[model samples]
Each structure stands twice: as C-alpha cells, then as structure tokens.
Target: MAQDFDIRGATVFSGLTPDDFTALAQVGRRESYLPGETVFSGNLRAQSFFVIADGGVEVLRREPDGSQTILARMGRGAAFGEAALLDGHPRRALGIAKGSTTCWVLDARGLARLRAEQPVVATRLVANLARGMAVRLVRASTRATQVVDQRRAANSSLGAGEARRSLMDRLFGR
Candidate 1:
C-alpha cells in the first residue's frame, strides 16, 4: 500500500521528477488515523505536512462563540499543513479525520533537512504549494458566485410573483 501511494501524486511534490520523488518518499513517514481523530488543532505549533493517501479530513476553525466552522473538506491525494513547514508558523486551523484515514506526514525538520541538502526538491515543493493555494482560491470564488446567482434568481422570481398578486387584488377588489 505504501508503494502504491506515490508521493509524486501529492501537490507538495507536484512537477518533481521521478528521482526527486524517490528522495522524498525515502524521507517521509506514513501513518494511519482512526475516525474522529484530531490530526492537529488551530493555533497549535505545526509539526508536519501531510498528504492524504485515503479517506477524508476536515479543516475547521473556531468562531468567537466557540462553534466550529468547517473551512474545507479534503479527500484522497490532498495535501495540508504544507505552508507550516515553509514559514514555521502555528497552524491556522484544525484538521480532524472524517473517517479512517491514511496519510504521509513529512516532519518539518525532515523537510528542512531535505531542503538544505536538495534545493531543487524544495523549489518544486514550493511551486506545488502555490498551485494548491491558487486552486483553493478559485474554488472559493466559484462557490461565492454560484450563491449570488441563486439568490438573484430567487429574488427576481419572488418580485414577479408579488407584482402579479398585486394586479389581481386591484382588479378583483380583494
């Protein structure tokens, strides 16, 4: 199963050559999590980057009222906590396993060591993170547009129905 989940497929390793991928696979450690497990929580120091090999994880944030809002849901082949390794910042969100999940987690220290020893790998990983961020932005924009469009259509139809009802009431003296 480990061999089947090629690290090259992960966004953090995108565009890397086969040799670079081999080097990364050598350095990363894979682990499995049971359902409802907390992969990491918001404001906590980030320890590693993960690429999901199977199942789902939820990225959530806590509101001021203490309610959790789901920021995103990621499934197989998705990567998370990647920027933490690059910037050494505490995680901004919590990641919880939605089900039994398999993930390849590359520790921050290991990634730093790899970056120092193999700069090209680092460069490729950076590119991959950028691409992933762009994709997320695009998806958010699309969803917002769809919501706006649906609201406008519903409002328009409601206005038209109201106008027709007013006309009928005036004509019938009701």
Candidate 2:
C-alpha cells in the first residue's frame, strides 16, 4: 500500500529524493497500530524496519528480574527495528505503539529489491543508518562512562572531610 508519507523527514531517509521515496514506497507498505499494540517483540525476528509516519513507538527491554524498561521512545520520522535489518540479528527489544501510530515498513523483499535494482539508493540508506547508529553509540558510551563515575563516587569513602584529607595527602608527601 503506497501511501503518501514525507519519508524525507526520517534521519535514515535523509538525502533521499522524491523519486527515491516513491521507489521505497513501491517496495514497502504503510501500516498503522493502535495504542499499546505490540509493533514488534523481542521474541520475533525483525522481518521489517519501520519508519514512523505519525505518532510514536516505545522500545522496551525485558529485564532479568521480569521488569520491562523503556529503552527509547521513537517519534515521527524516526526508524526502529533497523539493527536487525542491518546486522542480520534478531530483535533484542519490544516495540509498542504509545498511541495510534503509522509506519512505513520496508520488508526483506523490499530491501533486497532496493539493493539489487537501486544500489545507489540502498547505499545512501545504509550510510545514513550507519551515521545515526554511530551517534547513538557515542551517546550510549558517554552514558556508560557517567554511570561508572557515579557508581565509583557512591562506593568511595567520602565521609565529610575524608575526601579532602585523601586529596591533600596525595598532593603532599603523605
């Protein structure tokens, strides 16, 4: 179902032309989900990557203790379930509709078609995805570093003047 969606707004679709978007639409279909609906689950392999046309999707991860944590909230123009498509891996999290949401779904067949027939378009798409993923990686790395620092500070002996005393001792000959 080739519906009109401004795919240009999507980061992964950045630099794509109108004809390029049309080619993508020809390969994929548009789908809508209701609130609380499971768009994709960790148990399911990602058969497609979804670009939000409207509304949002909440990416959740199930913790070892049986609690689900929100990993991300993807708004319109954002793409989710892409890692699986790019890396040939299974989905590691669940994506649920936070509200009534619409997405442009490019399935494996579509991806293959793009790769084979429109190689330039496919290359651009992959490049954009890689750039986006790299930024996310950097952000995650920074967050991890912050968490480690916070944990170290919490674990350290910092009673009142203890930290100052330690610093002074280190600075001097003691």
Candidate 3:
C-alpha cells in the first residue's frame, strides 16, 4: 500500500500531474532516522530534497550560543531542502528527527535527470517550489510585523507608567 502512496499533496510535488507524480515517486529513495538523529545539518552540502513519509522532523536554527531554535516541526507530506537542491547552496538549517521518521529522498542528480527527460513535469515542480517559498516568506513577514507591534505596545505602556511616576513625584515632592 505504501508503494502506491500519492505525493500530490506534498508542496514540492503540488502542481505535478498524476502521471508526473508517479514517475517522480518511482525515483525517490526511502530513508529512516531515529529520534534525535540528524537527517541533515546546517552548512552541509545539500544532496537531496525530502518529503516526510511518516513521523516527524524538526527544522532547527543553531544560535551562536550553541543553542538550537526549532524553525518548524514537519509531519507527513512536508517537504524540505528544496532551496539548496534548486540552487546548489549549503543547507541553511538543520533537520533532525523528532521521532522515528521516514522520508522519501530525491537527489539533485535524479531531479536533473527527470528535468532532462520530462521538462513539463520539472517545470510544474519548480513552480510549486517557488509558490511554497513565497508563502513561507509572507508568513515570516507577517510574524515580524506582529512582533514589532507587540514591542511598541509594551513600550508605550512602560512610558505611561513612567509618566505616572513623574506626576506622583511632583505632587508629593519626592
């Protein structure tokens, strides 16, 4: 049954036709990772894009203080590492298994070969990747704006308290 699993819902394969999706799935390799195991680390050369087949993976950002912040917790059908696979750049974040996890991996070489053999499928895949990236960017921008607004509100409240303190000092001569 797993062999017939459809990848159409995965972001990387979102726009692909059924036939294209099936063809791509045939080329994907399955990989498993144990809990706390690193699936891929930041700054390493990205060799493949992955879609979670089961369980969970945590995408993390490592701070200068040697601590890690989770950027995302991905479940089944979530895809990652497309940016590096598309651009041939080093990975920007670490991917670690949150539990016993399985991923369907598609290497860059395989993707290139697919693109050469089936340009239309490749085009749809790339377009879907771009759309996914745009959505993430928009969400990040929205979160940043919300954070800034919260800080401004907190500062204004603090300023009001300070004003009250100053008025009290003047009236009480303290």
Candidate 4:
C-alpha cells in the first residue's frame, strides 16, 4: 500500500535526500478530491499541507462583492497550504480541486507524532518546510510587486495592453 504513494514527482519533495524522502513518505498519504470539491476554504483552520501529484487546484480570494478571484492555479508537483503547517494560522484563500485530483497530503498532527517518535526525521522535515516557505514568500513578493507596477502603469498614460505586456515580461523572463 505504501509503495503506491509517490512523492518523487513533487517539487517540494524532489529536493529531499533519500532519508528525508523516506521520512516524508512515512508520514504523508495520498488523497483525492473530485471536481468542484472544496479542499479547504478561506479563514478555516488549515489542517494539512498538500502537494499535487496529479491534476490542478485553484486558490481563490473572495471580494466584498462576493466575487472570487483566482489568486493562483497550482498544477502537478506544486505545493500549497504549507505555511499553515509550520505556523498555526487560518487559511488565506480557498483551495478547490479543479478536477479529479490526486495530492500527497501531510497532516500537521502526523508530523507532531513523527517528531515525538523520530526526532531526526522531524528536523529534516522542518528544514525542508522552512526552505519551501522561504522560496514561496520570495515568489509571492515578486508577483505582488509586478501587480502593483502593472496597475500603476495602467493608471498612467501607458496603455493597459502595453503595461500588462511589460509587467509580464518583467515577471516571466522574456
């Protein structure tokens, strides 16, 4: 049954060493969600971090007008809700399975258990998680800056299309 669980394709775990990967596999479990299923909702207590093994998920932000904006679309190998595992916090956005999706889910409580039983593995997991969070923060900050710049440019004499293209080029490495 454990052999069926695969983390090799996941970016978050791909960088892990043999022992680190083994430790992760011991605690992680593969879970599936159907189309339109709410994996977790904004403001709810985040229970687990997920790494997409197959399919996609969307992180959504709800505005005051009750309209939702896609904050991000997570594809295969992408990780989400990882920050919640490290720090106890409510979810910042809604994560919805875009379709029938397979994900490797790691429960925070499971990690706590592993920490008690295997301190070394716990240490590796913590370090890996920290690095992942740091990388994510950097990416998010860069994207946020681009968004602000795009809006600023659009409001100026610069046309929306040109502003958007310039922002995309700056963000996407053209």
Candidate 5:
C-alpha cells in the first residue's frame, strides 16, 4: 500500500534519493480512516507520525469547556505528529478524518531503523520537521498579536461610548 503512495514528493522527504525514499516508505504502514473517525486523540501516548496520502484531516485542540477548536486542516502530502515522533510525548491535539482519509504511519521504531540505516534521509526529515514547526510557531504568534489589537480597538470604542454617556448624564441630570 505504501508503495502506491510516493514519499518523494513530500517536502520532508525532498532531499532523499529515490532509493532512500523507497526504504523510508517501506517502514511506513498505510491505514485508512472513515469520515469523522479519530486518527488519534489528545493526551495519549504518541505512537507514530503520519503523512496524509489521500482525503483530509483536521487537527483540533480540546478546550476546558470540552469544545474542540480546529488548529489545522491537512490535505494530501501533509506530515504531522513529528514532535511526538521525536520526543515520545503525549499528543497535544486530536486528529480526525474529515473524509475517507489514507495515511502512511511511521512509528518510533521505524524512525530509529531509518536513522540507523539511512542517516542522510533521517537528517533531512528532521530538518524539514523543524522548519515546519518554526513556521507554525511564527504564525501562531502573529495571530495572538492580531487578537490583542482587535481587543484593544474594541475597548477603545467602548470607552468612547462611556465618555459620551457621562457627558449626556451631566447635561441632562439623568
């Protein structure tokens, strides 16, 4: 099944040679998920990294109120769960299939094997993961700043309304 999907086109596998990609692909197990099915959940032990081969997936974070906020929508060729693959930490978000999705899963054991046997490919993968993560962080920070600015503008408008109300009250004694 993995052989049917090409890993060479993925950004993380960009620098790898054809043979290296074949070896890496060999380590992956392909799985399909039905619509609305969970690919993985938050706070669970991270077992594997995933590359979307077909359909779509949503990455979501559960709020304290139990509502889930979507963090990202992934399409074909997108790679996710790299941080967990590296550190073996608990998952920070939930992954759900938006449709009938196909994914190539590479667990920690497979990553270790690839690192040992194809060090060059592993290095490129790691670099790509880091680059992807950094871009996400920057985008998040920018969004945070935008939210703060919006709130400030709203508060200023509210303050102006209050000031107008105070002046009207003073003049009319209401």
Candidate 6:
C-alpha cells in the first residue's frame, strides 16, 4: 500500500500494514485481461494467484464429457488461483475474464522474494490465503450437501413417465 495502491477491498490481503503492502506490491505486478481471455488454464501447473482489481472473472470447471461449468463469478477484491500460493499444483479449474479485468498477479519468483526478504509479510499473506480458502471449501461442502439432499427428495418424488437426472444435468440440460 504505497499511499496509492488500495488493498482495503481485498479480504485475502486484509490486516496487512503499509510496509507489508509496499513489499507485496513490489513483488507483484498489475495485469489486464480482455473479455473472454483466460487468466489461467485448467489442468496446467499453476505458478501464480490473482487478486482482481476491476471487472469480473468466471471460474469454470471442466467436466468429464467435455463441458465447462461456471463455478463462480468473482468481482473486484476477489482472489482466484489460490492453490498456487502454496504449491505448483495443476489448476483444478479455469479462470477467464468476464470483461476488461485487471488483477495483481503474484508468481513463484515474487513469492520467493517475499518469503526470504519479508518473512512477516509472507506469513500474513499465506495465513490470509489459507483462511479465505478454508471458508470457500466449507461453503462448497455445504452446497454439495444441499444438492444431495435435493436429489434424494426428487428421486423419491418421481412421478410416472419421468426420469431422474443430476442437478448439473438439469441445470445444463446436457
């Protein structure tokens, strides 16, 4: 947070001091994406994470039958590709820009610099990322449970001449 770069809207970067912000901004750079452009591809090794500064992003999951499902719509202040913060894991989904989106992009080299030179800032960042990811995981789990419960009820209430289909199938009609 130079006296200029704003970090207040970003929950994953919350509680960081001014010095922390300066260090973070030093390592990461701002990048913009055009509408429908990919920020990161699914199934590839992830090297960075992004914090949206403007516009929106669609987090899409690749399906078994070659379909893509929109998992989330992220707007300003949202962080995506979070798994990249901890490891070089294959991304589980794709993130594409919904419009003229700008983001603070942090890659492995920058992260390494922060960890070595600004350990306190790095720890705070990692802790924040983990906390945010845990919350998201919990929400996803709750939604999945609700879907299962709904399917069970639907299956039991099936009427004659009707067939059962999954929630995804019904929503996507695929």
Query: What Cα-based lDDT does every candidate model obtain?
Result: 0.77, 0.78, 0.76, 0.76, 0.79, 0.81
Clashes of each: 0, 0, 0, 0, 0, 1
TM-score of each: 0.70, 0.78, 0.73, 0.73, 0.74, 0.75
In terms of lDDT, the poorest run of 10 residues in model 2 is: 162-171
lDDT digits (tens) for residues 1-174 of candidate 6:
333435456998889886888898789888778999888785432568888888888989889999989989999888877776677775777888999988888888888999999999999999998998899899999998898778868776885334466666667787
After aligning candidate 5 to the native by TM-score, how far in Å is the CA of 107 from where it should be? 1.6
By lDDT, the better pick of 3 and 5 is 5
As for model 1, its CA RMSD to the true structure in angstroms is 9.7
- Which residue runs of candidate 3 sit more than 4 Å off their true CA positions? 1-6, 43-47, 145-174
Location of the lowest summed lDDT over 10 successive residues in candidate 5:
162-171
lDDT of 1: 0.77
- Candidate 2: stretches off by over 4 Å: 1-3, 43-47, 64-66, 149-174
What is the Å distance of residue 108 in model 6 from its true position?
A: 2.1
Candidate with more favorable, higher TM-score: 1 or 5? 5
Candidate 5, residue 39: lDDT? 91
lDDT of 5 by residue, 1-174 (tens): 256776558776666677766777767688889999889886442568888888888989889999989999999999888888888886878899999998888888888998998888788777887887888789988997786667666666787656445433555798
RMSD per model, one decimal: 9.7, 6.9, 8.8, 6.9, 8.7, 5.7
What are the per-residue Cα lDDT tens digits for candidate 1 across 1-174?
Answer: 258775556665656887777777767778888999888775443657888898889988888999999999999988887667667786878888999988888877777777887888877777787788778789988997786667667666777766445432555788
Residue-level lDDT tens digits of model 3 in 15-119: 567688667766667788899888988544365788888888898999999998988888988988777778887687888898998888877887888788888
By TM-score, is 3 or 6 better? 6
Q: Model 4: runs farther than 4 Å from truth?
A: 15-19, 43-45, 142-174
Query: Which candidate would rank higher by lDDT, 2 or 3?
Result: 2
The top-ranked prediction according to TM-score is 2
Q: What is the RMSD, in Å, between candidate 2 and the native fold over all Cα?
A: 6.9
